[model samples]
Target: MPPANGAWAWLAPGNSWGWSNAGLISDGEESLLVDTLYDLELTDEMLAKMRDAEPLANNIDTLVNTHANGDHCHGNELVCGAEIIASSASAAEMAELPPEAMAAIVAMAPDMGEMGRYFLDCFGQFKFEGITFTPPTKTFEGELHLQVGDKPVELIEVGPAHTRGDILVHSPKDRVVYTGDILFIEGTPIIWEGPVNNWTEACRRIEAMDVDHIVPGHGPITDKHGVAAVRQYLEFVHEQARQRYDAGMSAFDAAKDIELAEYSAWSDPERIAVNVDSLYREFRGEQAASDVFELFARMAALAGYDVATP
Candidate 1:
């Protein structure tokens, strides 16, 4: 559904894995797409919806990827004709893991033990094959201003939090902000890049905006209240992770030991493992990258997989 100003949010179901949201700003003749979905089929479905809602969307004039995550940008190939824009950091990160990686992971899922089964459960619905990595044609550093027909849109880079190049797409005319992964609604947000503080600050920035509708990269459409929810979760996890860090606990141990309490009900609660790992690295002033397989194993353990006995 579109807000009063022709800004539409394509929301996927909550509590489901790889279910992300996309946004569209139409001016009756041209449409600007905020982000694409995880797979070709999903993207096609979204585009079809947009076309039905606003014929202008049939000719997407511009596309902005809020971040580098495949769930947000994997369908770029489907919109290859549009002029793609992203932060330079995100453009760089986009090439680091292409669709081929997703294909390989799916191909090996059958033999990955419990982790494999869990991986399939999360992503098995998406088709990873035949996706071509299409990097952004243009990149910016801090801010960019453009127009979707007559509606002015501002792009603000707020990353090294959700991902290296996370951004917020704000349309002042529409009073909507498309927060790519920077706000994950009711879901437990995964921190691939964080000092935790940065993520929290990003939420505050969104709160500072004069917007009525917020389209999150994942989950339902929301407002500042949604931003606050994500901020609270980040702060809660940061404090918990810090307590464990002070006790010299391993990231995995801290993740396992921390009590989720109010956040336990969020979707993908095992993402606490990734959040804790990122927080531990921040606490130690170490590099933020970790082996993906090891992180998944840790998450699997926290989610009830016992690798030692399996």
Candidate 2:
């Protein structure tokens, strides 16, 4: 839904994982794309929708990737002409996992046994090939200001939480804030990076802002309440993980034992495994350096996936 002003969002509905949300802010002549989608086909569809709204969207002058995650920046090759921008940290993280990495994952899925099957189920449709890694040509640290013609847009870096560098696109003129994975509605948020406190504070920052429509990285168009809901989930999970840590339980055991009946209705409940593991590390004042594949393997096990016999 397009906001009250020139702000617009492309929300991919349902609980299908990796179906992230993107936004556009156009003022007739110039436009800014909040983020791209997970793959070539998805990004093409989103660009088509945006073009339908305004032809200016077809030639977006600036592309702001909220974070380095492939889902947010993978389709950047499609808009190579635009000057891409991101937080300095995000630009660094962008290089950490390239399109080839995704391609490798897809190829290895079959051999991964049950875990591989679940991996394909979550991310098989994405066409990772032909995705050129277009790192942000311009980067900023904390805040940056820009304009979609006359409407003002503010980019706020709020990370070392969702990822090494997550950001929010705030349209003060439209009273809208496009949070890139900082808030997820109707879905469990995987904590790829966290101090837990940084994430909760990020949510609180949004709560204090005088904004109307809140555009989350995934799920439906929301408001301040949606932001609060995500924050509450994170807080609850943090406490649960903390108790398990105090008892010296493994991340997998703690995740399996913790009851998320309250968030049971949310999609991708297996993400609790990742969230608990992340919070446990944070609780112990440890470095945020968990192995990605190891985390996924643990999640697959917790989700009742049976490993194939050798």
Candidate 3:
């Protein structure tokens, strides 16, 4: 059975990633949506499904942007008159990234711009339009409890790891936790902002939770084991990156040098660069903000092309 609380999850696949999905949730009265997909068409389908599941989007009172990633919140503008909510950190990070940037990135195709086109085609599959920039109607620190009709949900802050404002949504009564990007179930876990250890710890915390159902920000619905696998990946990558960084290896060299043979089967093998980049910054302390561009460049090397930038 799908999640109750009037929620619906659609598995959106193909394009760049082999598997990617989006979700919707409602609470009878005012619905709360989590992680809208890339564009209006996809988002419209998700909304229609949500309405089919429960009549909420027609009058959604609140919306939450788990984090600022495009796949998660690109279709936000479609939720007309809905009060948007995200951690201050998430809002800030998202504001810095305009949908135009993504549109621009995806504008390229193979050949003169093969890599850029690949990224654009993959990440660009989700249509983004009419998405006006609306900051969160409400922001909170630590934890926030919300009532969507009678459903009680917890908005948790577990970031400075995935992104500055990464959050997980927990519904204790429902025994479900929507782990934004904290857990990527069967997909490549990337750390745009990380202390890899913090991410490792977040996984531990997830594992320790009373909840049994987990909805990863990406990939299919999963369980604690799925959570554990992601945790293990981060731990392994952290150790691996640290080894190369200590040897004074550049982030690119580390991406190439580290084989990750143990995780050879993992999807998006290129994300090793993201893990390396995040770990490198952690190793550098306050003086560093990982160069996301450089990391993307290295990632593209391993991935065969740059799919995120145009």
Candidate 4:
């Protein structure tokens, strides 16, 4: 959906995994892209469509990755000659799990039991092989302001929440915000890195913004109402998980026991496992990151699938 005044949001249909949304902000011959697709083929397809819709897309001057997530930035190699920019934390985190590692994990899935099946179910659609992992060429910590022709764009860092570094690409002039994974809309948000409070605070910041169009990292384009729903979910989960933590319940047990109510209807409800675990770690003041495979195994268990210990 193209918002008024040269702002366009490329939304991928369905709230399922790996189908992320991207955006293009153009004025005159200058353009800035917000994130990319999951793989080369998907990115290529998106770029083609974008070019057809807006001529400025033919030569993107800048590319801003909202976070370190593979779905948001994995197809970066396709945007040749564009100066890639991201938060310093995001850039550092990008190297932690490259395309080769992801491809290798998916390849081993057949013999790995239920967790393997679950992993494949989420990411098997994308081709991760042969992708040259592209890191950001320009990195910043606090905030960076740029001009896309005459439109003023602001990159606001709000992270250590979704990931080590997450950002919102806000076009103040056009009243549109490209929220990385911070706003999941119809999909349940998975907190891979969080204090819960930080994520909630990020939501509040978005709600307080004057923006009219909210372009989420996943799901359809939305508005402040969508922002409120996401914030409500975060607060609900945080309170629920805190109670379970105080009761000495294991994160996995708490994830299965808690009632999601309305949020259960959201796509990928199994993500609550990771969210609860992250909250528990926060409560304990633990700074160490959990093992990704172990977390997936826990999520698989919560989803009623047999999980083999990794």
Clashing pairs in 2: none
lDDT: worst 10-residue window of model 4: 301-310
Candidate 3, residue 130: CA error in Å? 5.0
Model 2: per-residue lDDT, tens digit, 1-310? 6875788988986545678999998885998999998888899988988889778887899999999989999999888589899999999999999988999899899998888988998888788887877789999999999988889889999998989999999998889999999988988888988978889999999999898899999999888888999999999999999888999998888998999987888888888988998888887788857887887777777667874311
lDDT (C-alpha) at residue 276 in model 3: 78
The best candidate in terms of TM-score: 4
Rank the models by lDDT, top first. 4, 2, 1, 3
lDDT for each candidate structure: 0.87, 0.88, 0.73, 0.92
Superior by lDDT: candidate 2 or candidate 4: 4
Give per-model TM-scores: 0.97, 0.96, 0.89, 0.98
Model 2 misplacement above 4 A: 308-310
Query: lDDT for model 4, on a 0 to 1 scale?
Result: 0.92
- Model 1: residues >4 Å from true position, as ranges? 308-310
Top-scoring candidate (lDDT)? 4
Residue pairs that clash (backbone atoms under 3 angstroms), model 1: none
**Tens-place lDDT digits, model 4, residues 1-310:** 6976799999897768899999999997799999998899999999999999999899999999999999999999999999999999999999999999999999999888888899999889899999999999999998999999999999999998899899999999899999999999899998989877888899999999998899998898888889889999999999999999999998888998999998989998999989998999999999998988899998787777887543
Cα deviation at 22, candidate 1, in Å, is 0.0
Residues 233-279 of candidate 3 have per-residue lDDT tens digits of 88888888889999999876787788787676766778887777777
